[model samples]
Target: MTQPSREAIQTLVTQCLQEILNQRGTELSAPLTADTPMFGTGGLLDSIGIVTMIVDVEQTIAAEFNATVSLADDRAMSQRNSPYRSISALTDYILGQLSEGA
Candidate 1:
């Protein structure tokens, strides 16, 4: 199987965020910044919502790249940084996984 491209990964992340926002449709006083936390204080994703995002990301990566990515695995989960923190962070993490698969 081939690795996922950076562009594809970015699209997936953006789609995940947008879908969640669409469902919740919250009245954000201000648009969320790139640095905004995603799973903690000021985080946009609740626990259940996080699962949805995760499933969507994984499935999209698999289908789009013809490769399987398990971000829930040991190395990813143990990282000093959390991929779920922000869109940029998640993009980098997905790219790293694709690189490893390559």
Candidate 2:
């Protein structure tokens, strides 16, 4: 099977984030587009919100791609730039993982 492209990754990220936010009872003021930031610094989500998002992303990846991913961990916490910061960043992070055979 062929792997998805970068745009597909971004789309999935937005879908997962939006779905998870809705489940958390948080309606985003704006629709989650490619540029929508997951972290509160740029968008509507806070730290705890990102944590919930991480869990959702992990679940979606596992179910959809049969890939187990760790979205929230020491690497995330200690990084100068967080993977959940924005849609683009998150997409890059996920694609990197997919490339690494994660």
- Cα error, candidate 2, residue 71 (Å): 1.4
C-alpha lDDT score of every prediction, in listed order: 0.76, 0.76
Q: What's the residue-level lDDT of 75 in candidate 2?
A: 85
Q: Could you tell me which 10 consecutive residues in candidate 1 have the lowest summed lDDT? A: 26-35
Q: In candidate 2, what are the lDDT values of residues 1-102, reduced to their tens digit?
A: 356688777777888777767777987677777777778576667777777778877788788777866767688777798777788888888887777773
Runs in model 1 deviating more than 4 A are 1-4
Error of 2 at 52 (Å): 1.3
What are the per-residue Cα lDDT tens digits for candidate 1 across 1-102?
666566667767877777887888845666665556666567888888777887888898777777777867887667778888887788888888778778
TM-score of each: 0.81, 0.80
Whole-model lDDT, candidate 1?
A: 0.76
Cα RMSD (angstroms) for every candidate in the order listed: 2.1, 2.1
